[model samples]
Target: MSTTSTEPARRAGWRTETFARLDERLDRVLGATAKEFEKLRVRTVGDLMLHVPRRYFSGTELSDLSQLRVGEEVAVLARVLRTDVHQGHGGRSARGGMNSRLTSVISDDHGRLELTFFGKPQVMDYWRRQLTPGARGIFAGKVGEFRGTRQLTHPDFVILGDHGEIVGGAKRNAVLAEVTRQPLIGLYPATAKLRTWTIAQSVGLALDQLAGLPDPLPAAVRRQARVIGLEQAYRAVHQPQSKDEIDGGRERLRFDEAFALQLTMARRRADAKAHGAIPRVRRDGGLLAAFDARLPFTLTAGQVEVSEQLMSELARPQPMQRLLQGEVGSGKTIVALRAMLAVVDAGGQAALLAPTEVLATQHYQTVLKLLGDLAGGGLLAGAGPSTDVVLLTGSMPVAQKRAVKLKAAAGEAGIVIGTHALLGEGVQFADLGLVVVDEQHRFGVEQRAALSAKAAAQPHVLVMTATPIPRSVAMTVFGDLEVSTLKEVPAGRADVGTVVVDAKNHPGWVERAWQRVIEEVGAGRQAYVVCARISSQPKRKSTDAYAEDLDTDPGGEDIEPAAAAVDVYAELSGGPLKDLRVDLLHGQLSSEEKDAAMSRFASGETDVLVATTVVEVGVDVPNASMMVILDADRFGISQLHQLRGRIGRGGHPGVCLLLTKTAAGTTARDRLDAVASTRDGFVLADVDLEQRREGDVLGASQSGGRSSLRLLRVLDDADLIAEAREIAEACVAADPELIDPGLSDIVTHVERQAAGDWLERT
Candidate 1:
């Protein structure tokens, strides 16, 4: 060959050499000193670290022979009493072409077992010569079932007679019962090479060759978390010596995960507090007094306590960053109104932001009613003839919007209520002092920063979430912000006694309930029929018929009105109830339509309004007493609680009917029963957590990417998580910056937690 032609092979050899050297460097990087295989080309050590299991075979023990089920790998020791070479059993020859031909029978005193050596007559010859017929040999092999009998197929056996200890052992029993397994053996799963012997072979090699990988967590982290190192963790996880070790490792991982999360939250809070520039205002109690005096009912102790704490925060110079948490109907709004009043009386503008326009309108109207009568000059009336409160919803008239915009910009709209639309670029505040955010958990940390940036000075913010967070979770998730809970309900409000009724019994319940509503309305009360599905949801194709898609709802305008689902709305409004002012209220309706429907409902124009859970939050129709659900089982207990909260605001003998359709399934019945048992939303939340896992709870993926977790479980280790979180706090308190040399490795670990792809390597 010419030199030019031979260059191609030379270059190929060079590339292979380069690859080998790179792999060597990677191995060094992964702390490997010696390369194991000289011929095989390997990937980077980092790549190898990510070689988790395709599956786990989970090892076993031979002692528990009775526990040996049909599908288990059992190891036994036996003597090879005899060996024989023959042609293949089923009329095939072993001494020929590449075929499954050679057969050998291995025998012990217990029995004779056949061993097949496919296409390898030399294998039999080697065994016969080495084993020496009638001399004892040790067999380390897999047990296979052949013709309803246990047999060893192509077993790996060694002659033990040559060994000095077993020189004359063939006279005794040929089989030895010294069988031992890892007890609960963990396997590296199988591949296409799936004979029971195949997986066993790979595992045997791996166990012999693989070294225990070290966990990098420092001693301080382990001591603080009351846990073990990474190697111990892996061992305990796979081949746990005892139940206690397994539990201990699990505790360590849980604590580590929770501690990481807590540190992140704490760091964010501390950084924000440190970097923020807040305007401290002197204490003002006069406005709160006036607002409370005009209120209709006495404040619950929880409300009073929260209100006092919030007022104290406002009174100080510190940025009033606090989370206002409580169950449904626990009077968080009243506390918000009082805090806003405090800012208003201080001659500072205030904004009350809500997640939905419906809630904004309701809150705006409540404030308007309070300020318009007898003290009409207290709040902005927008473009309307009065000057009591400014309602800046997307549905408001353009002129009204302009007036509210101008007044809020000029520091004249003392208290403004609106949706996230209020955070629009065009809106400017004269001096935003108090910003009350409803459904706080619904918003993220970045949104909080953007909203705070809108004011002249960073405003004191009071965040509210309707979810009744458990006390333990509250401590960590909202640890940065001061927490104020509203436990007790308002006085004179009747407890909405919940009852679960299955749909197997749901035929005439709606009609019967409607009749009761008619009587209550005839007696001057209103009724609400909450439909589950909205109209815009795509209809399931007939071919794609799946039972779970039956109640799938179609569409809604986020931050707007609830959309109409034709089925339920048509059943109630287009059917027998046509005579009443039965109107549809949904998020898909135009702004004007939503405003018209809400205004009519507020003005007693619509007697029975059919809608979705869009009315769940804060739409207060005092005269609306009866709440009827069409497909109650389709919704979570939290949603059910919110819907029930819409009614019972009027102080009448209110009744709620939860009508469930798919009542047959056990899960469906449990959901309905959970709703029917109590009105305590917090308790229901705990139950909700117990039922569903973490993925569905935080609802993270819908907002963006998947939630971060590898092997961590949220609910399974709640107690461990809580304890871990406390230890993390203490650790950080001891070393505020995590600059301690001992924790530097963990600091790198935490940084990599939010970074890309590092976890995937692990």
Candidate 2:
């Protein structure tokens, strides 16, 4: 009792005194430059200190300028070889009436680069004098090429003396000295509005004002983990003397991020255990058992094992927070269905939230077909003890939606499945015992919380994703939730063969791909034609699945837009596969139109379904054995894997053609080749993680905020994350309430930053 009483006083004292310096506003320290710093989101002294340099340049080392790629932002130190000023076009005023140009040639040890600036005569003369022959300085800008010559147009630069000292006026030297004084010059992430030297000066000012930094990690944990303290880390990261110091500082900070995250997760788990949960124990001869007995096929051993784990956890009086990830078509839906039925049998309701309307509707149909008479809920003749299944979507008619809400509120609907509409108004549940989220990554924390709020008590949550996550990602991102993996695909599932149709080198391959689709249709099988967009309109946004796959012209070169479903459907239905029946489906289409297209394809009434990635997940058609993806290079690796998973589910072997205009030996083509080479989702998952920033993997994109993890890499720091998790669990076991003020503050800060998504608060 005395310990509890002192905890509040200790926390208050720490907040008021220990962290006061960190909480100080940047304006107090940085004076006028604070406004510029604020543009980078460094509003506080602590934020400024934590803004570590992205990379460092060594005064003793020089990089090969020849290797620099176009479109890359670079900071290079070079000596000016020559300078010239040209007036207008070929020394005469042409277009725009102000075409004076200042050009200079700069070179390092390896290669030469050209610099150009276009302005009025005064501006050109000023630049010409600044970039005279023999001048050595650091030039930074986006690498551009003109007439096959590497160049930086109107780049940011700082001249340096022979002794590596910045050569400038008193005020200029003062700002850049904080950045150039060390043996290793740090290159920070700078923007067009704020240069690197100004940010360094701001950091220096903030650092000088910081009186002290309280370490969040306990001394013993630091010793065990072999990491430095917070103060040393800040100094080493921002003003390092050597690369080794940079390494040490980065590791320590990464551990801080991991430890804070793990502690939050552990505390959440403990709090969840402390709460009272209604037990959803499965009973004998219940809906689950009855359904299982009538199944024509046997469950895989992996499925059976995962099912038992879920059943055991659900039977307990603690809310179940489990993440079920498996290979595509590995039967995660079956396992989730069994758990939902267990909750229904325990006199409760279950809700399945899908990311897309198509998936929700497909799940509704799949459940009905699987249950047959067991879903009658006493409304049908010769039905046993059963319950009703309802599908609620935003596109549903008002009457239909109202009926679903009434059934859900009255506890008549044993299972509820819907899109985001289920989280909207007037959706109540009599006894919500479980929630099953499909493609869990697509939904954010607030949406989950809203559904949980509908329950009288915290409902058991089972999130299922078809995109197989690497173990390291599973630990780092979903640490608070228990993860169950299913790797085995059910027996009799046919093999899927992937082929890359390079349209750039082999233009005929495009026609051949269409021919293959026609042949599959001729064989009494349906096919899918996937596109990156709905239409070619410039203002229309890409579908959610292909949102990140939009074409980017970094080199300022003309490039064609990605293939669109509407255009492709028109072309195929009129030109290549004109004899076959084809229907278009995309996000822009009305719900009724989309549903009709899917229905036609599923029932074999449509020979080909041309659509965007709306069918990326959970749209199953056994007879659809072929898929041809147009401009497949635009899609991500995991997305490509998920898209192909639609085919190959039936007993017949499947064929997937990836048509791309990307040339060979390019990054885009390599990604497509990797997807075509193997079908292992786990392997592809690791590759995907390696290619993407850790922030995206941790749901920072969904939350629309900076990533909670600034220094930690979910891929490279796997072992560090594992060790931190172990130490955090031990710390939580010792102090379940996180009474230590410093540690508690760290957890709170991380949670606040990632409030909407990353941590998934209990």
Best by TM-score: 2
lDDT of 1 by residue, 1-762 (tens): 011112123333322221232233333443332143111122343222222222222222112223222222333333444555665443444444433343444453445554545445564455556655555443434555568755555554434433212332212222221111233322222221222223333223332333454444456677766688654554554445566776665566556567766665555455455434345343334555556666776788888788778777787655777988887778888788878776766667678888777778788777777655523544432332223357788767788889989878887777778876786788888777878888765554444555667776657888888876665456544655778878787766765666555544666765777777678778887888887657745444322111122222211112211233556667767676766777788877776777788889878998988887678788888788888787676566667777888777757867888776554545656777777778888888787656643433442211222334434556566676677667666667776665553343443434433333222321
Question: Which residue pairs show backbone clashes in model 2?
Answer: none
RMSD values for the candidates in order, in angstroms, are 14.3, 4.6
Model 2 Cα RMSD, 1 decimal: 4.6
Tell me the RMSD of model 1 versus the true structure: 14.3
Regions of model 2 farther than 4 Å from truth: 1-46, 64-67, 79-112, 118-135, 168-173, 378-383, 539-559, 700-707, 756-762
In model 1, which runs have C-alpha deviations exceeding 4 angstroms? 1-218, 230-248, 275-286, 373-409, 423-428, 455-458, 536-564, 699-718, 735-762
Candidates' C-alpha lDDT: 0.58, 0.80
How high is each candidate's TM-score? Answer: 0.66, 0.89
For model 1, give the 10-residue run with minimal summed lDDT: 553-562
